[model samples]
Target: MYSHWARFAVFVFCLTAPLSIAIAESDTGKNNPANLVGHGGPIKAIAISGDGKTVLTGSFDYSAILWQLDNTTTNKLARRYSEHEGAINTVTFIGQNSRFLSAGDDGGVYLWDRASDNLLMQFKGHQAKVLSLAVSDDGKLAASASWDRTVRLWDLDNLKPLAILKGHKGPVNAVLISGAGQQVYSGSYDGSIIKWSVKTGRQERPLYLHGWGINVMKWLPGKQQILFGTVNGDVQIFDLKADSIAKVLIPHQRPVLALAVSGDGKFLASGGGDGLIRVWNTADWSVVEELNLSFGPVWSMVFSADNKKIYYTGLDDYAVAWKISPRKIGQEVQGKFPRRFQKLQNMSLGERQFARKCSICHTLKAGDQNRAGPSLFKIFGRPAGTLKGYKYSPGLLKSKIVWNEKTIDQLFAIGPQHVTPGSKMPLQKISEKNKRQALIRFLKANTQ
Candidate 1:
């Protein structure tokens, strides 16, 4: 769900250290800052291989890093790849996870085969910095857009220039390869998207999509709906069902740097100048998750094939990954919140805050293992004295206090030490009344 407050946080983040220059046009503007990942360098771009076994990224530092993606990693399993002489803008894993490709500020494209850990080939053809790139599914062709105002096609087999697709008066910002493996979509400053036939190296569909230059178009994994990440921060969903624009998803505060369709195509991931990753549910076009990064505009992103994780990059030359698959589901129940909690939305906020602050010490629901603290899922209305197989302070056992709103508040604010001097609790008083009250009310309402 999109939270106005969360979105506001993203807006502030963009202003401080913009993730991209394209964020000037976000209309819907629903971003979340709570997803922040505290880090120094902001990421410029990120990519995951077809096998979902590896991730690659490039940054302002003129370097790239590869991650193994899961827990199966160690110092030897991960290593930094620094072959580019300038800031790397884009990278992609080649067919069958055999090789990798990168385009950068050097106005050159370099091919790398990790098996040899050596530069396989370098195509120094573009006159300007390459901003975007795409590789066909069969891995036979490569298309790149450059600040030089041109899109160049390269043959992966022999590393030769196939042809240069021109006509955009300004720089070409983004490009994509369609799922059919036959077409190439390029978005340029000319405010149009041009489609090229990959076979004969000819223009297939020209002057289509977006009134202004389209920033990006991502083909969903399972459906024909193509999602476009625009400089305007509006994510457009083109549904084959409607044979047109099915929905326009604008939820970021800045120009979208990248548009990634989940491997299953059930969700859409958008990241860019906003330093936030917004995941929109394909069924409703509503944002379901907002993951925040601490710095840099996300220049690009890619999802693991199983939809289990997400990887993105920022301008700061860093790459990061997040878990997204086997989606975490929270346990929900009825009548667990106060009647006065009239604001269902407030309850959600309160729940989130509670989870953040208290989950470590106590269990609020079933199946959540107790750490150093006790379970509070049903603590209200019951005698607060004792539970089976638990340790209780002698003072608390003697005080015989009941678990109620007032008692809970006093225990938290005044501290268990004051209420029951000999209590075993190791804590201090909670200073804020509102927070204490929210916690007390929440615990009480869920007791039943």
Candidate 2:
């Protein structure tokens, strides 16, 4: 099995100043014109409006941000919505950019008004995390795939559930609605793709099956073909009419996690766990551009309206753009390195342990609340779930456990799930006493 895939900047800018000046001031080092850097955690989902004037990104920080993009100026973070209780997994523009939908680990699919930045409705029914979302061509219906082993169809106009397409035998990982909104397709960890009738929630037929789990899927132009990426790194096209594989693309050595097609259907882009992205010309399926991010796995990607640029999100806290036009195909992407968690020579064992275990989510410094977890600075005597401005789960708040050497040691020894049930902290355990001691020592020394 694939056990290697680990789950994978806050820029403040003056509002009244010129947009270019704001980006120039905040974007020092690796930040550039092609980067949208404002999220507190790794961006998991990205969507661009039809006009390409706006961008939406969902993140592990449990927030979705709206951004303004223009030809004359750099992109600016416009608004942030943090209503979700868990990490956001999918986001898309619905109803012609006037509204949008966001789904997350909390199993809630939120409908929002784009203009007012208000929550219009919360479509809740999924028992587990929602992984992917798709809207119909006419924008009247939407489908959401969830780990609950179901794909829920929604009437976008009525803001209600239309049907629960429940044929998948395993956690549904990807979902797609046909162009005419008559059929829905879902791919699952069970390695089967099932096509369902949208109106009756009945299984139409099994489309295809592979040995590996399907990670992402997309409907190609004309709806006669479908492109999908698998956990085993196979990017293949399935001809719907023939019910057979049309083309096979082996672009990555690791799991293929993302697939995107341009609005005009001229290009296709795929990203994988190897931190590589390949852009293909759909006409001939020829590789036009390839980029080595040298950072982390890409989780989501979308092409700009003009199809000249690709916007993608990875483990980094920002969305990056790659120029895919012929003029800028091979240009090197600069300055995303000296990662905070990267190991250096002669580091202590405790420091290394911190880096491997806690560095990605918890920062050691105060005033650095840009990560998913609250800062651990001065954590020795702090009470659990008491950090200001950091949202804590109700279960954690009710636990009333104080952070001290004993509690901290017990936390890792028992794991967060046992110590604080229902908390947002991911399941982690330090079974080795020496390693736990090292991590605790590192936290004690650095957290001060």
Candidate 3:
């Protein structure tokens, strides 16, 4: 679906750390923390283990981190996996938490063994970015929805593709597997939800036609109902028994990006592009609590097994776990967050140009390899792809282009795709000559 508009680049590097690394824990207590800091870029997807003892977060940094959750003043980060060539979009613990799956912009689905922290398999068939993934209750089957307008069913046990289900007129954004593993439901940007028979590999029936694009979907506890959040900020519940929409709620004026159902089946949390999170009581579908996330849009969310906390991800570099029981309306202080790319009040024209054109993917300091793109420090005289640790694309590694004033200006003048064809650099251009000059001047002044 590519629900978020931002794009991040990638580079592979050797890992030197062991399985567990000690990180400074926030003193915000047990149920909630201000943030879990690890990923160098914005978090995009999150998943919690059934026992609530562990958390897995995927990010635009092209890595997924596993964390040990507890009530102490310190949290132990278990491991980090960085096999993907692009940003991670979805991650889930499957097969009784013994194995896991992660898919992303690279259109590749990765299966990993949790205990060994080793990649077991990689499934590739989708032609575009994979948006969502769902596993059956028994964990024997998995389904993936992609921007290619197709849904693929996989035999999780065999780690092979089982069937390709296609019917959507537009990109498929969300998918769900039935409790018994008999049916798969897929929702698309075309505003239609279709049910497919897993065994027959055919569309059994059309579920519902939402007026707006569906961004996310979750199954209610008993499997008799489905809850979905839309691109137009509407959260609607569909009654499977009645075969119609039963309830509708507008929690945000912008796109509803994330939704999570509590493990205990007591509460449902919905977050949107408006930076608001609304908690609802499942029995009555009434609002129980509201949180204003002053940071930015919510990208993904998950509930702790105990139902007392909701872990969410957004544009911020760190992921946050919010306390749910006390029901306090909390919000981050605006303009005070520590995001690296945030605009300063006294920023000049050249600075603004850098912030807009280069900040999201590139860093300015030496030894700052955490960002998606390589650090730009002392780049004015370097040859392309000559950085110490970053793994550049084959085309970039063989390119004759050097990082000079004329080359840098021309790189963005026509776009990276034109300047370095087949490179990992995203296709972005500064159409205005002055804006290009300002960005180049800013890079020259700061990158040294």
Q: What is the lDDT of candidate 3?
A: 0.78
- Model 1: per-residue Cα lDDT at residue 34: 12
By TM-score: ranked, best first: 3, 2, 1
In model 3, which runs have C-alpha deviations exceeding 4 angstroms?
A: 1-34, 327-349, 367-369, 386-401, 418-422
Q: Is candidate 1 or candidate 3 better by TM-score?
A: 3
Q: Candidate 3 lDDT, tens digit per residue, 211-245?
A: 88888998889887899998777899899889998
Model 2 clash pairs are none
- The global C-alpha lDDT for each of the candidates, from Candidate 1 onward, is 0.62, 0.79, 0.78
Where in model 2 is the C-alpha error above 4 Å? 1-30, 294-296, 329-331, 334-347, 396-399, 418-422
Off by over 4 Å in 1: 1-14, 17-42, 72-77, 207-209, 239-243, 292-296, 315-317, 324-448
The predictions' CA RMSDs to the true structure, in order, are: 18.6, 6.9, 7.1
Q: For candidate 2, give the lDDT.
A: 0.79
Residues 1-448 of candidate 1: C-alpha lDDT, one tens digit per residue: 2244235424533443334322223211112121112222334566777777666766544556666655333211255565555556777777887888888767888888888778888887788778777887888888888878788888899978878887776677787776666777777756677777777777876635566556666677643656776666777767655667777666567767687887666777887666677777777778776655534356677776776656554432134445555544321011111112123354454464465455434566665433334567678766765765445546666877887778878877888778767754544566788888777666666645
Each prediction's TM-score against the native?
0.60, 0.84, 0.85
